[model samples]
Target chain A: MKKINFYILLFVALLSVLGAGCINEQTEDVASNGESGENEVTGTETQIDTIYQFSVIDALLEGVYDGEITCGELKENGDFGLGTFDNLDGEMLELDGVIYQVKADGNVYEVQDTETSPFAAVTFFETDIQDSIKTEMNSQELAAFIEDMLPSQNLMYAVKVTGNFSYMKTRSVAAQEKPYPRLVDVTKDQSVFEFNDTEGTIVGYWMPEFVNGINVPGYHLHFITTDRTAGGHILDYTISSGTIEIDSCDSFYLELPENENYQSTGLSADNEADLEEAEN
Target chain B: MKKINFYILLFVALLSVLGAGCINEQTEDVASNGESGENEVTGTETQIDTIYQFSVIDALLEGVYDGEITCGELKENGDFGLGTFDNLDGEMLELDGVIYQVKADGNVYEVQDTETSPFAAVTFFETDIQDSIKTEMNSQELAAFIEDMLPSQNLMYAVKVTGNFSYMKTRSVAAQEKPYPRLVDVTKDQSVFEFNDTEGTIVGYWMPEFVNGINVPGYHLHFITTDRTAGGHILDYTISSGTIEIDSCDSFYLELPENENYQSTGLSADNEADLEEAEN
Candidate 1:
């Protein structure tokens, strides 16, 4: 009888330990999830081939230059993208997981992860199609050539062109102060940079007409030299030879800025004419 | 010794059972979440004020009539909004978590969970503002009043107007056969319905200009009678007494359709004029 009682006590003790093990497993599982919540990744990772955009082109055109999303947050979403820094400072281009800022002085610098952007579009760069330029082509002809190669023009494409350019004309905006002028006005005073016989890469998006208000509708490319030193919003580039890769983005995630300026600004007015002038 | 031996076997059996229970818990967690991959919910339960749209309006305008999102899938996203069914069969409206289809026969039917949609927009309805229309107002007057009351036209809104209308004019298109006709052509021969002094709700989205290509730039609404027996896409309505509730949607999730028809469709064509003609 004494032996049976001792065995029974041992059995109860072992059962509790096993039950405790199960409880700890669940607790650890939940704790790990809670930790990830602090990061951009949730229980599931963000989907690939999706273009994540912060704010709208219309808002930026109207000079809503301060945004909430940090450069760090945007980098987590995509390794490639293009946009403008806070205060309409300069042209921002992300390539190969690095964010480069072309300041108003026409010099390129590494963008700090803590810096914020007013407008930007980014996607994981996965080349769905590739074309090599065997001959020379100007901006229009190159654009037309790239356009013809897309599987469908209805979808947005992240375009990357790497090669030699005989001429590259670019512009970067100066950081603005208070009482910000319209984007078109700022572009008028933008610092222009010209490059000849340069080896660089052009990265941007080929957006559809529907994105006219949300983003620039056509090719909005920015060039970065091989050394990652300098580039700006591409005005025109005469390519002697290049290789173009396009990533077809099927999904779009647009997060509107919650700033008071974004809410109070007049975004309904037809800004197409102004947008065309400013982007060029 | 025999009793001790018996106790050891029981303890081992019980321990393995508990271990299996924990293993099953983890397995079930992932299995349940994804077994229904067709109804995969995004990481955030979809933001309250975000407008979730499947496919683009230009695709529909160009006769991409079939889609892949089931009615059940859309319901998981939002309980309020509007859209059309696959094959352009009829107008679809969701209110109070129920999907109602206003068919070409001028009859409202509960949409099946299995029914797919080609184009639709939905949002979890949470009214940020409410206004009472005590006096009579025509369609144009009502629209203008709502426009003036909006804080900013930059954001989208899910509008719900429940009231008595002196005159209501609505239309619904029949499901097209193979080789679907352009939306403009379908609307030319659409079935029209008129009601005198009807009690119902006008449910739809008031999108910003930026959504011109992806969604209707302005108001796109559907009507369902109080009895849930009849209604269609709202053409015109004269409100005698009504209460308007608007939920401002700040984020947008656009999921492009992957159907062969959608892939083959030419979505880049400017269908703004045709959209205006068909919608009105």
Candidate 2:
């Protein structure tokens, strides 16, 4: 009878251990998640509508251009957007899950998954509003058109415009050497490209004014030709005819780099005038 | 022999079912988590040093006076901070996990978990820097002293000052009725209270200027006495002696309210001057 009692105790102990082991395995899966915003993206849900950005525009304006996020990592959070390559190499345009680099040499190159960006904004674009612009409209006019048609100016938007353009003016910065100068100084000697009757797409974001220091207050756009051959940061363009798709984003997840470059920069000072000059 | 084999098969199947059941129960606990920002707080590891805020200050300025988040839900994200109650009610302050409501009647009351807020910022307070102030200093001087000592103006800080005050002045707004007036208008006739030789603790945050529309640009504080009896939004104070503790927060998680009132408010417009008037 004592032997049977000992056997029963052993059986109960084994069952409890097995149950606890199964529970720990499940908890460990969740416990490994890094941060909340990060876990949300890497988790199964695949956050679609969030304006996920790596670093702030002020960091770039302050010339903190060393990339902290890889293209592969960024792509997981977004399938469409724009940014600049590591060391401010060139303008980056991401559309339909692929990243394109428009170098200052007026050549477009596909980026490696390991390549990184100093600053970028991207989202898994899903059109909330789709409309066609049959008439000719300059950059300002097109901006105003979309501005008026948006449900609310307060929300962030990922805008994609694909069409034939009468004229498209763009600029790209050369990869900077060590001791990078401020973006304002670099843009003073940026390479400019002008395309006549170019067929391409404009990928960009229209952020609210509250994001003045964090991101560009208005539209910050990049372009890629129909053949995926050429494009750069859009300076100005006259869209002869185009289809505009705007993805209204209500959530924004900003992950700031904690590098010395990002931390040491005097981000509080007014960069509006400098940002306006560099962006334009 | 066949009967014995059937029993053995049944026992194995039961064990597997029990294992799966345990695993599912653990996973469901995490699966019910609403959002990442929220999940991080409600999770086992309480997130520290995150400047967590619900709704934008611009919403309050625009008269979006309805509460969307319960005090209980907000406390999960923070143990110290300040905001107002539902219906644009009196000032609210939280310290050491307890929330206090300072009404326009010049009385402080303990708040229930079910109570809600439309706009508020909170953080789990952990001291990174602690110092004692022996010399008397006016509000401006005290603010400048703390401001100069901060590692970076770019980062948000939760500030707590506990000591003897030569003089303290605070204000609390009355709960608004339907068709709520703008916060600026409400402040114009706010109830003010003054105390001499007050022994209390000042709880607040000092956010960067970039948070202009989202939150107050500079110091936004509320006060509660040492006895935990009386307090309101800090307007002016002269500290004869105090202990200041600052918690520098590098991460800020903002969760905006999506109610019809929040959606309809024109948050894009300039609210700087109005904010200054209302806050002061």
Candidate 3:
């Protein structure tokens, strides 16, 4: 009876040791993930998903970013989509009636079943980083680059010719409506650039220029707006217009152009008559 | 007595007619002003001490702009001081220990002290068309123009190495302690690009092969920032440094070089560590 008991105890002890060892091995195996696990690595596992956050030094340093976004959740086979400035591309990516294509970079993956959460993004940069944060850019580093890239008025010119001349000019507004757009140059005609539906308020000038390698002076008119659009499209808003005029020297000839909507007022150049009326 | 009285009356009537003509000329001149007394053909007066507000826009139509400020009095032939971001001969121009350069092609004026208010600050492209409501860019246009001139990131890559190989990779943070600095690739230990302390940020990247005519990898670095310069200095604070590491089989080993400041941390082969930490 004693010998039998010893054998049973020994057998139980051996099984317990094996069980503990197996559990440790399983934990270590799971922890050894190339991207998310806690295990130590033995070889290169570049084909994996990782998460990284970037640090932004300046609060005012915000603008458009160019990158990619994957599925909302993790899945096998590494299927995902991509996003660029005005468009998204991938395998059957259709958002709001717009189709997108994939980036073909092989580092993106897709999430299954969930629709509200769009995509799960990833990167392989040795230092884990996200598109918004890990741009491989620092504050000072970005500022320097921006300084060099700044647009200056040095490449443009301003000219004025008044006192009885009817020459042509061009007005060029941005493809999208941008508020406080740079007023480059204006036309020689009496046309005015109007703002949003605010009648009798001319805010810009109409200048002409060439298009498609052809000199189409005054063919294209431009105005400045504070609106934007990815694909160039005109907005459904009211606009003000300005016109040119020539007045006689004797009359109080204010060059207020005639407008069908806004009545044009006339003035006489008679100085004494105007002064007498003011005094009375 | 009757004949003399008749002659006097005729003389008085003729004098009145001539005076009326002169008065009419003055009245016409004022009317030609388009009821905009401040709208002179020369230029709008801008106050040097005035403050302007600004903002950024980045939809399809992207821009930055300054809002509004009172125009300062103008002086003829003023000896105005140099402004910021002014370029001299394609390089940033320096005057009185200040860099002054504008990107647009327009007339540059030196403020003179002869007039009542010779001092003047800058405005942006104008679009307002309400008579003398000249669309000289309020603050918004100026802000947008400056913002547009900044640089952007085109491409980025992640770097990783496997095994226990030791190597050295050194590059220059050329815009040290500057507002927005640029990074340059250095093969041989030599400063290919000079530094600008006042601008104190990495402004651009000087590729080794293209800039120095050397056969090297496209080890190009691009950096950009939007933080404005304060008191003519580039940087407002310091940023932390980065680290380097290597990948083993299923585990990642932190690699630390002798006397190196970077902190090397271990990463898993599947990136499971990073994933879990993010959730927490």
Every candidate's lDDT:
0.79, 0.79, 0.18
User: Could you tell me the lDDT of residue A226 within candidate 1?
Assistant: 90
TM-score of chain B of each: 0.84, 0.84, 0.14
CA error at residue A115 for candidate 2, angstroms: 3.5
Worst 10 residues of 3 chain A by lDDT: A246-255
lDDT of 3 by residue, A29-112 (tens): 422422333212211121222211111101001111111222232111111111121111112222211222222221112223
What are the per-residue Cα lDDT tens digits for candidate 1 across A92-196? 998776788999898889977899898988876766568899899999999988887766656788999999999999999999887888888999999999999
Best by DockQ: 1
Candidate 1, superposed: residue stretches over 4 Å from native: A1-46, B1-46, B268-270
Candidate 2 - CAPRI tier? incorrect
Candidate 3 iRMS, in Å?
39.3
Candidates 2 and 3, the one with greater lDDT: 2
TM-score of candidate 2 against the unseen true structure = 0.79
Ranking by TM-score: 1, 2, 3
